[model samples]
Target: MFIEERKFEYWMNRLVSHFETVNRKIDKLSNTENKINDEVLLDNQDLCLLLKVSKRTLQRFRSSGKLPYKRIGKKTYYLESDVHEFIQNGFSKK
Candidate 1:
Protein backbone atom coordinates (compact mmCIF):
# COMPACT_ATOMS: atom_id res chain seq x y z
CA MET A 1 0.00 0.00 0.00
CA PHE A 2 2.77 2.44 0.89
CA ILE A 3 4.72 1.74 -2.33
CA GLU A 4 1.58 2.19 -4.45
CA GLU A 5 0.84 5.56 -2.88
CA ARG A 6 4.40 6.77 -3.54
CA LYS A 7 4.21 5.77 -7.18
CA PHE A 8 0.90 7.53 -7.67
CA GLU A 9 2.17 10.74 -6.12
CA TYR A 10 5.27 10.70 -8.37
CA TRP A 11 3.15 10.30 -11.48
CA MET A 12 0.86 13.13 -10.41
CA ASN A 13 3.82 15.49 -9.94
CA ARG A 14 5.16 14.69 -13.42
CA LEU A 15 1.76 15.29 -14.98
CA VAL A 16 1.45 18.67 -13.30
CA SER A 17 4.91 19.69 -14.50
CA HIS A 18 4.04 18.70 -18.08
CA PHE A 19 0.91 20.86 -17.98
CA GLU A 20 2.92 23.85 -16.77
CA THR A 21 5.31 23.48 -19.69
CA VAL A 22 2.44 23.38 -22.16
CA ASN A 23 0.92 26.53 -20.67
CA ARG A 24 4.21 28.38 -21.02
CA LYS A 25 4.52 27.35 -24.65
CA ILE A 26 1.01 28.59 -25.41
CA ASP A 27 1.72 31.94 -23.78
CA LYS A 28 4.90 32.35 -25.82
CA LEU A 29 3.05 31.66 -29.07
CA SER A 30 0.35 34.19 -28.23
CA ASN A 31 2.94 36.86 -27.56
CA THR A 32 4.67 36.15 -30.86
CA GLU A 33 1.41 36.56 -32.79
CA ASN A 34 0.74 39.89 -31.11
CA LYS A 35 4.17 41.17 -32.12
CA ILE A 36 3.60 40.14 -35.72
CA ASN A 37 0.24 41.88 -35.74
CA ASP A 38 1.87 45.11 -34.61
CA GLU A 39 4.42 44.98 -37.43
CA VAL A 40 1.72 44.20 -40.00
CA LEU A 41 -0.33 47.11 -38.73
CA LEU A 42 2.48 49.53 -39.56
CA ASP A 43 2.59 48.32 -43.15
CA ASN A 44 -1.20 48.08 -43.56
CA GLN A 45 -3.12 50.91 -42.03
CA ASP A 46 -6.84 50.77 -41.36
CA LEU A 47 -9.19 51.59 -44.25
CA CYS A 48 -10.13 54.98 -42.78
CA LEU A 49 -6.51 55.98 -42.18
CA LEU A 50 -5.10 54.82 -45.53
CA LEU A 51 -7.74 56.34 -47.84
CA LYS A 52 -8.69 59.35 -45.73
CA VAL A 53 -12.26 58.36 -46.54
CA SER A 54 -15.36 57.67 -44.51
CA LYS A 55 -16.76 54.23 -43.72
CA ARG A 56 -19.35 54.60 -46.47
CA THR A 57 -16.66 55.47 -48.99
CA LEU A 58 -14.67 52.38 -48.05
CA GLN A 59 -17.74 50.21 -48.45
CA ARG A 60 -18.40 51.73 -51.86
CA PHE A 61 -14.84 51.16 -52.98
CA ARG A 62 -14.93 47.52 -51.93
CA SER A 63 -18.23 46.91 -53.67
CA SER A 64 -17.05 48.60 -56.87
CA GLY A 65 -13.67 46.78 -57.01
CA LYS A 66 -11.78 50.03 -56.61
CA LEU A 67 -10.14 48.61 -53.53
CA PRO A 68 -9.01 45.00 -53.22
CA TYR A 69 -9.19 43.22 -49.88
CA LYS A 70 -8.91 39.86 -48.18
CA ARG A 71 -12.01 38.74 -46.33
CA ILE A 72 -11.08 36.50 -43.42
CA GLY A 73 -14.17 35.08 -41.84
CA LYS A 74 -16.21 38.18 -40.84
CA LYS A 75 -13.40 40.77 -40.97
CA THR A 76 -11.78 42.34 -44.03
CA TYR A 77 -8.05 43.06 -44.39
CA TYR A 78 -6.19 45.03 -47.06
CA LEU A 79 -2.63 44.34 -48.13
CA GLU A 80 -0.16 47.21 -48.19
CA SER A 81 0.96 46.41 -51.74
CA ASP A 82 -2.57 46.35 -53.14
CA VAL A 83 -3.51 49.64 -51.50
CA HIS A 84 -0.41 51.39 -52.87
CA GLU A 85 -1.02 49.98 -56.32
CA PHE A 86 -4.58 51.27 -56.31
CA ILE A 87 -3.31 54.74 -55.53
CA GLN A 88 -0.56 54.66 -58.13
CA ASN A 89 -2.28 52.94 -61.04
CA GLY A 90 -6.03 53.15 -60.56
CA PHE A 91 -6.87 56.51 -59.05
CA SER A 92 -6.91 59.52 -61.32
CA LYS A 93 -4.66 62.48 -60.49
CA LYS A 94 -6.49 64.87 -58.16
Candidate 2:
Protein backbone atom coordinates (compact mmCIF):
# COMPACT_ATOMS: atom_id res chain seq x y z
CA MET A 1 0.00 0.00 0.00
CA PHE A 2 1.24 3.52 -0.83
CA ILE A 3 1.07 6.22 1.87
CA GLU A 4 0.12 9.79 0.99
CA GLU A 5 2.64 11.52 3.32
CA ARG A 6 1.70 15.11 2.47
CA LYS A 7 -2.03 14.52 2.93
CA PHE A 8 -1.42 12.79 6.29
CA GLU A 9 0.75 15.64 7.55
CA TYR A 10 -1.75 18.28 6.47
CA TRP A 11 -4.70 16.57 8.21
CA MET A 12 -2.71 15.98 11.40
CA ASN A 13 -1.63 19.62 11.55
CA ARG A 14 -5.19 20.76 11.00
CA LEU A 15 -6.46 18.57 13.84
CA VAL A 16 -3.80 19.82 16.24
CA SER A 17 -4.56 23.44 15.33
CA HIS A 18 -8.25 22.89 15.91
CA PHE A 19 -7.58 21.43 19.35
CA GLU A 20 -5.33 24.34 20.29
CA THR A 21 -7.95 26.87 19.29
CA VAL A 22 -10.62 25.07 21.30
CA ASN A 23 -8.34 24.87 24.34
CA ARG A 24 -7.53 28.57 24.22
CA LYS A 25 -11.21 29.49 24.01
CA ILE A 26 -11.99 27.18 26.95
CA ASP A 27 -9.26 28.69 29.10
CA LYS A 28 -10.47 32.21 28.42
CA LEU A 29 -14.02 31.33 29.31
CA SER A 30 -12.88 29.54 32.45
CA ASN A 31 -11.08 32.61 33.75
CA THR A 32 -13.96 34.91 32.90
CA GLU A 33 -16.41 32.56 34.59
CA ASN A 34 -14.35 32.38 37.75
CA LYS A 35 -14.22 36.14 37.98
CA ILE A 36 -17.96 36.42 37.40
CA ASN A 37 -18.66 33.76 40.02
CA ASP A 38 -17.19 35.60 42.98
CA GLU A 39 -18.65 38.98 42.14
CA VAL A 40 -22.11 37.90 41.04
CA LEU A 41 -24.98 36.61 43.10
CA LEU A 42 -27.21 33.74 41.94
CA ASP A 43 -30.84 33.46 42.85
CA ASN A 44 -32.38 30.23 44.15
CA GLN A 45 -33.56 29.08 40.74
CA ASP A 46 -30.18 29.53 39.11
CA LEU A 47 -28.38 27.85 41.98
CA CYS A 48 -30.67 24.83 41.88
CA LEU A 49 -30.11 24.33 38.16
CA LEU A 50 -26.37 24.74 38.46
CA LEU A 51 -26.04 22.25 41.29
CA LYS A 52 -28.76 19.97 39.94
CA VAL A 53 -30.30 19.83 43.38
CA SER A 54 -33.72 20.65 44.74
CA LYS A 55 -34.59 23.85 46.60
CA ARG A 56 -35.17 21.95 49.83
CA THR A 57 -31.56 20.74 49.77
CA LEU A 58 -30.35 24.28 49.40
CA GLN A 59 -32.47 25.37 52.34
CA ARG A 60 -30.98 22.57 54.36
CA PHE A 61 -27.49 23.65 53.41
CA ARG A 62 -28.20 27.24 54.40
CA SER A 63 -29.71 26.19 57.68
CA SER A 64 -26.80 23.86 58.41
CA GLY A 65 -24.25 26.50 57.41
CA LYS A 66 -22.93 24.43 54.53
CA LEU A 67 -23.66 27.18 52.01
CA PRO A 68 -23.63 30.87 52.79
CA TYR A 69 -26.31 33.09 51.30
CA LYS A 70 -27.94 36.51 51.50
CA ARG A 71 -31.39 37.98 51.43
CA ILE A 72 -32.37 41.19 49.74
CA GLY A 73 -36.06 41.78 50.32
CA LYS A 74 -37.74 38.35 49.98
CA LYS A 75 -35.20 36.98 47.49
CA THR A 76 -32.26 34.80 48.41
CA TYR A 77 -28.93 34.79 46.55
CA TYR A 78 -25.61 32.97 46.79
CA LEU A 79 -22.13 33.84 45.64
CA GLU A 80 -20.57 31.55 43.02
CA SER A 81 -17.33 31.25 44.95
CA ASP A 82 -19.14 29.85 47.94
CA VAL A 83 -20.70 27.17 45.79
CA HIS A 84 -17.39 26.33 44.17
CA GLU A 85 -15.70 26.15 47.56
CA PHE A 86 -18.45 23.93 48.85
CA ILE A 87 -17.94 21.44 46.01
CA GLN A 88 -14.17 21.46 46.30
CA ASN A 89 -14.26 20.89 50.02
CA GLY A 90 -16.50 17.90 49.52
CA PHE A 91 -13.93 16.00 47.45
CA SER A 92 -12.69 12.83 49.14
CA LYS A 93 -9.80 10.58 48.17
CA LYS A 94 -11.07 7.12 47.58
Candidate 3:
Protein backbone atom coordinates (compact mmCIF):
# COMPACT_ATOMS: atom_id res chain seq x y z
CA MET A 1 0.00 0.00 0.00
CA PHE A 2 1.31 3.40 -1.01
CA ILE A 3 1.06 5.72 2.00
CA GLU A 4 1.65 9.48 2.06
CA GLU A 5 4.91 10.56 3.75
CA ARG A 6 3.04 12.87 6.13
CA LYS A 7 0.65 10.09 7.25
CA PHE A 8 3.55 7.65 7.77
CA GLU A 9 5.47 10.16 9.88
CA TYR A 10 2.37 10.85 12.00
CA TRP A 11 1.80 7.14 12.57
CA MET A 12 5.41 6.61 13.60
CA ASN A 13 5.26 9.54 16.02
CA ARG A 14 2.05 8.24 17.55
CA LEU A 15 3.52 4.78 18.02
CA VAL A 16 6.62 6.25 19.68
CA SER A 17 4.47 8.37 21.94
CA HIS A 18 2.41 5.38 22.98
CA PHE A 19 5.54 3.38 23.76
CA GLU A 20 6.89 6.23 25.87
CA THR A 21 3.68 6.38 27.87
CA VAL A 22 3.82 2.65 28.49
CA ASN A 23 7.44 2.89 29.55
CA ARG A 24 6.61 5.66 32.03
CA LYS A 25 3.82 3.58 33.53
CA ILE A 26 6.17 0.61 33.88
CA ASP A 27 8.76 2.79 35.61
CA LYS A 28 6.13 4.10 38.01
CA LEU A 29 5.05 0.57 38.88
CA SER A 30 8.67 -0.47 39.40
CA ASN A 31 9.18 2.45 41.77
CA THR A 32 6.09 1.50 43.74
CA GLU A 33 7.32 -2.09 44.04
CA ASN A 34 10.69 -0.88 45.29
CA LYS A 35 9.01 1.23 47.96
CA ILE A 36 6.89 -1.67 49.09
CA ASN A 37 9.97 -3.90 49.34
CA ASP A 38 11.75 -1.18 51.28
CA GLU A 39 9.00 -1.32 53.89
CA VAL A 40 10.35 -4.82 54.66
CA LEU A 41 7.77 -7.39 55.62
CA LEU A 42 9.36 -10.17 57.69
CA ASP A 43 8.06 -13.71 57.53
CA ASN A 44 8.21 -16.35 60.27
CA GLN A 45 11.69 -17.54 59.32
CA ASP A 46 13.07 -14.00 59.24
CA LEU A 47 11.62 -13.20 62.63
CA CYS A 48 12.89 -16.47 64.09
CA LEU A 49 16.42 -15.80 62.81
CA LEU A 50 16.44 -12.21 64.02
CA LEU A 51 15.10 -13.17 67.42
CA LYS A 52 17.31 -16.27 67.59
CA VAL A 53 14.35 -18.38 68.61
CA SER A 54 12.80 -21.57 67.36
CA LYS A 55 9.65 -21.59 65.24
CA ARG A 56 7.69 -22.98 68.16
CA THR A 57 8.86 -20.12 70.37
CA LEU A 58 7.84 -17.61 67.73
CA GLN A 59 4.46 -19.27 67.56
CA ARG A 60 4.16 -18.78 71.29
CA PHE A 61 4.76 -15.07 70.87
CA ARG A 62 1.97 -14.89 68.31
CA SER A 63 -0.38 -16.93 70.42
CA SER A 64 0.35 -14.88 73.52
CA GLY A 65 -0.27 -11.62 71.60
CA LYS A 66 3.22 -10.34 72.28
CA LEU A 67 4.06 -9.92 68.60
CA PRO A 68 1.79 -8.39 65.98
CA TYR A 69 1.52 -10.13 62.63
CA LYS A 70 -0.56 -10.26 59.47
CA ARG A 71 -1.57 -13.60 58.04
CA ILE A 72 -2.05 -13.79 54.29
CA GLY A 73 -3.39 -17.16 53.27
CA LYS A 74 -1.21 -19.62 55.25
CA LYS A 75 1.78 -17.26 55.52
CA THR A 76 2.42 -14.76 58.29
CA TYR A 77 4.16 -11.45 57.83
CA TYR A 78 5.30 -8.84 60.32
CA LEU A 79 6.04 -5.23 59.52
CA GLU A 80 9.57 -4.05 60.18
CA SER A 81 8.27 -1.19 62.30
CA ASP A 82 6.21 -3.53 64.45
CA VAL A 83 9.18 -5.84 64.96
CA HIS A 84 11.35 -2.88 66.00
CA GLU A 85 8.67 -1.74 68.40
CA PHE A 86 8.40 -5.25 69.82
CA ILE A 87 12.12 -5.34 70.53
CA GLN A 88 12.06 -1.79 71.89
CA ASN A 89 9.31 -2.78 74.27
CA GLY A 90 11.72 -5.35 75.81
CA PHE A 91 10.23 -8.47 74.38
CA SER A 92 11.94 -11.54 75.74
CA LYS A 93 11.67 -15.23 74.90
CA LYS A 94 10.38 -17.07 77.91
Q: Please report the candidate that would top TM-score against the real structure.
A: 3
* Candidate 1: stretches off by over 4 Å: 1-45, 90-94
Give the per-residue Cα lDDT of candidate 2 at 16.
Answer: 100
TM-score of 2: 0.55
Superior candidate under lDDT, 1 versus 3: 3
By TM-score: ranked, best first: 3, 2, 1
Against the true structure, what is each candidate's TM-score?
0.48, 0.55, 0.57
Report clashes for each candidate as comma-separated counts.
Answer: 0, 0, 0
Candidate 1: 10-residue stretch with minimal lDDT: 34-43
Overall lDDT per candidate, in order of appearance: 0.67, 0.80, 0.85
True-structure RMSD for candidate 3? 6.1
Give a tens-digit lDDT track for model 2, residues 34-89. Answer: 12334878888988898888999889888888889888789888887787897787
Q: Of the pair 1 and 2, which is ahead by lDDT?
A: 2
Compute the lDDT for candidate 2.
0.80
Give me the candidate number with maximum lDDT: 3
lDDT of each residue in 38-90, candidate 3, tens digit only: 78788888888999989898788889998998887898888889899999987
**In model 2, which range of ten residues has the least summed lDDT?**
29-38
- Compared with the true structure, the alpha-carbon lDDT of candidate 3 equals 0.85
lDDT of 2 at 91: 18
Task: Supply the TM-score for candidate 1.
Answer: 0.48
